[model samples]
Target: MPSVEILSRIQFAFTIAFHYIYPPLSIGLGLCLVIMEGMYLRTGIKMYEDITRFWIKIFALIFGIGVATGIVMEFEFGTNWAVYSRYVGDIFGSALAAEGIFAFALESGFLGILLFGWNRVSKGVHFFSTIMVAMGSIFSALWIVIANSWQQTPTGYIIEGEGLEARAIITDFWEMVFNPSSVDRFSHVIIGSFLAGSFLVMSVAAWYIVKKRFVEPAKAMFKVGLCVATVAALAQLFTGHRSAHYVSEYQPAKLAAMEGHYDSSAVAAMYIVGWVDAKSGKTTGIKIPGGLSFLTHGSFNAPVTGLNAFPGTERPSAVNFVFQTYHIMISIGMFLIALTLTACFLLWKKKLFSQKWLMTIFIWAVLLPQIANQAGWYAAEVGRQPWVVYGLLRTSDALSKEVKAEQVVFSLVLFSLVYTLLLVLFLYLLNKKIVHGPEMTPNEEDDSDEFSKRNIKQLQA
Candidate 1:
């Protein structure tokens, strides 16, 4: 049987991975909703308002599940990682309090208006509510990232006790919030959420176009999604590069593992796709010679600290796993950029929706951004393994002393069952919504008919 620590870790990973699916959707959909509502306010287009209304229902569904699943992690902290919780409580307390005050409050307060105030509130008030909800989601991400980043590169805190009694005491609240990895990681995560949300819109829109149902609104949604995906994909490249630079400077072992570098003195070659044989301390595949060096140091000859420089115990043991996941994320990012730009070109030539191949691709392409987001998250979290809180705390030592492996196993099974049911329910409702499509009044239907007639030629071509 696995130890309690192993079981607890697996349980947390399972729950968090499942829970993570919704937040990005929430954040991304929030942004998309804001855009759609803003367009409604600007142009007096009822279709945009209808589109906004449809997605708001989906967004609320995502937000509800996200909140429900997220609450599990908080409890797990106390039940499975009691020691770790005690250690980080002082630091996390302030951050969580801030999240409640600045993020959740704003988000939840306007949420009612955004959801049920359609006829009750003025159009301007409704739009304002949408904007506030989107901003609230962004703020929520900010505090969560700040807390996680502090774990990655802990600072502005000092150890106050010894051994099991030890805890991190916050020295400067601002410094802890603005830790070295916070901004870069925050931007990366937020952009990733945007990509996930936009692609979802695109996927559904593309499906509608292919089926010739609600083609007008689908085209509008597809255009908006394509626009956001393009910008986010481009920005991701810069943010990812910046993130790598920071990891190189502050977390050399993890950077080395990510690139599959082993030699202490040799210039690190960046693998395009490779296999790392940990036993042989070698990575082999097609690579750009000194590519890692050039990217990290601005020169081909610059030396990057390698895994060999760190003790075996200190290095990420799953070198190849990290390498593969990191590459997967990079590969997906490039693919999104290419896909979006191609769609944009076709759109510019007025040939976007008519292209059955492109529309079909977009129909299924929603999974790509989600896959990339999960891969990136796994790479970051797993690469930092062995250490629960970087240099300050080891994961092995963080588990609750009273917890047993059997208890953890039981809870894991229970969680798996419950989460599976949640997944099924979520899918059933989502499919129902997509199949029903956008709602339209009699006048709006006439307008859509006229709009379709104007664009029927494009569909034919």
Candidate 2:
């Protein structure tokens, strides 16, 4: 049996990983909703309104699931990680409070208007509501990322006690919010969310085209999705580079683990594909010599601090695991960039939709962004291993002292069963919606008062 600590960690990781799937979808879909509704208001085109209305239902479903799953982490924090919770309560409390006031309030307040206000409110008012909901989602991400980044590179707080009694007290709120890693990590996370949203759009649209249903609206949606995907995929390269630089500066040991670099005296080699023999400190792969050094320091000869620089107990234990996950994320990012860029080029040449092979690929490409997001998250969190809050606290010391291994195992099993059921239901509902297509009745497709009256009646029904 795993130790109580191990079981607890596994449980938390399982819950968080499962919960993570929906937020990116919600955030990304929020942006697409904004764009679609904006287009509706700008052009007075009923097709755009139909598209916006269709995705709003999907967005609401994702948001609900995301909220439901996210609440579990709060309980886990108190029940499984009591010590850690007490230690960082002040800091976390402030950030979460801000999320409620500035993020969730704005989002939830306007969400009803965005959803059911289609005929109840004017088009301009509805569009404004859509914009508010989108911005609110982004703000929610901003605060959450800030809190997590503080764990990575702690600042703007003072340690108030020692040993088990120690707590972090916020001294500079803005400084904490803008900690060294926060901006870069936030950008990376948000851009990744955009890719997820856009890819989902493309997948559904491509499916529609392939099935020869609602081809025109699907093309319009596909075009919007492709544009968003292209910009986001390209932006990811810059954000990833920026994040790497920050990691190299603030968390050298993690950076070393990510690349499987073990020789303190040598410039790091960046692997394209690799296997690490941690026992022997040998990493075998096709790699560019000094590639990591050059990327981090702009000099091929620059030496990077490596695993050897850290004490055995201080360095990440699962070095190879971090290396593989980090590499997988990088590889997926490159693939997305290539795929989107090529698709954009083909689109420019007017041959995009006809490319059945590429359309088929897009139909499944929704998984890539989700995979990359999960992989990147794992690499970052695991790479800092041994520490739940980086230099401030060790993960081993953060667990609730009285929690038994059996208790944790039981809860883990229960969570797994519930989450599996939730996932199945989500997929079933999503597939039903997709199959239904975005059908606009001839009466609802009109621009006159008749369209308004029909929409109101449909809403009442």
Candidate 3:
């Protein structure tokens, strides 16, 4: 039997993966701009001013793509998931509208000032614009998270009617905003963005060092990346822990699936790495005793529900895989934190530049966190299986009734091809910009000439 559920999932996954490529960058870069502008204001550093300008150009490009792709996802909710939209429309519409009115407007209005008003605006005004841009990103995340959290821990909504005609209405806006799962998820997402941004900074800095270009500017960027990555990574651990606890409490079925538990137990073992046997309802390869219990309940022997407790229709089939993937993502995130902090320490000891291996590792480290972010998102969304609106609406019921599988399949293929082309173009242009480097100041060029002469003499000796 061909299932529309499969098509719905495929379309949703494609759109989300494409749209997601940009938001973390925007969120992280927004914060980076704030830090850069603040440094310029505090120290009167001309280099900080120049670096901000350089990064702002890249930010503008990425931000535009993010906005465009994000719009598609919104439309997709109505187009492909019409039933889902109708079911939770009242609740989601308000949050999205607020995002546009409160966050998008502020971001667009001030982004121009941040990017192009350097000469037109006063220093204080410029700094204020940067702050506003950062706030705008945060504000945007707030509303979006509100809508998503509603799915995870539905509140402030009352269902009316029956079966296919049932619809959810917003009864309380504040309650929706402050839903039990909202804060933890929002915090975790924002921190993940910060981690992404910090890694971007470090990766670029590593590239600069490898090429022996813009040493001072690169060092400054590295320092900012180090601080951000360190703090965000640590914060992610805490927030993720909190989010996991919330999931265990509010969505225990998901927790059980994530850990591949088949029977309820006082102490459940977590799989650090393994494959799940769906037929047998068990995990294989490896396991960590009581780790799942400790993670969810903060105790070694706390009772945790298992998949067997839930009906067949209620269980997510890939629970163990999702759980293991999530654990791997977190492990990579922790490693990034440690790596960035260690690089910072080495830099402090004047040894970072001398260690090509560490710098090489740092150059590629950003990829790990990016993958982790995507995997984390996949786990969160997919592990909530069978239901699109938690207990309120099943995903199969929420798919568009009129939309044919072939129509969706065609669009999916087209979108994939177009996005792949755009991705290639983006990477090429980005590489070109990085290779060109920033426009050099006159004094910087003079200093570079002298430094080159000294280097040549040392090489001759």
* Candidate maximizing TM-score: 1
Put down candidate 2 lDDT per residue, 69-176, tens digits, no spaces: 999999999899999998989989999999999999999999999889978998889889999999999999999999999999999999998998999999999999
lDDT by residue for model 3 (323-386), tens: 7777778779778778867877887798987787887898998787778888888888889988
Give the higher-TM-score candidate: 2 or 3. Answer: 2
- Each model's lDDT comes to 0.91, 0.91, 0.82
Model 2 scores a C-alpha lDDT of 0.91
Give every collision pair in model 2. Answer: none
Q: Return the lDDT, model 1, position 193.
A: 96
Model 2: per-residue Cα lDDT at residue 325: 94
What is the TM-score of candidate 1? Answer: 0.97
Stretches off by above 4 angstroms in model 2 are 443-461
Poorest 10 consecutive residues by lDDT, candidate 3: 449-458
Residue 252's lDDT within candidate 2 is: 95
Candidate 3 residues lying further than 4 Å off, grouped into runs, are 447-461
Q: Candidate 1: deviation at residue 453, Å?
A: 6.1
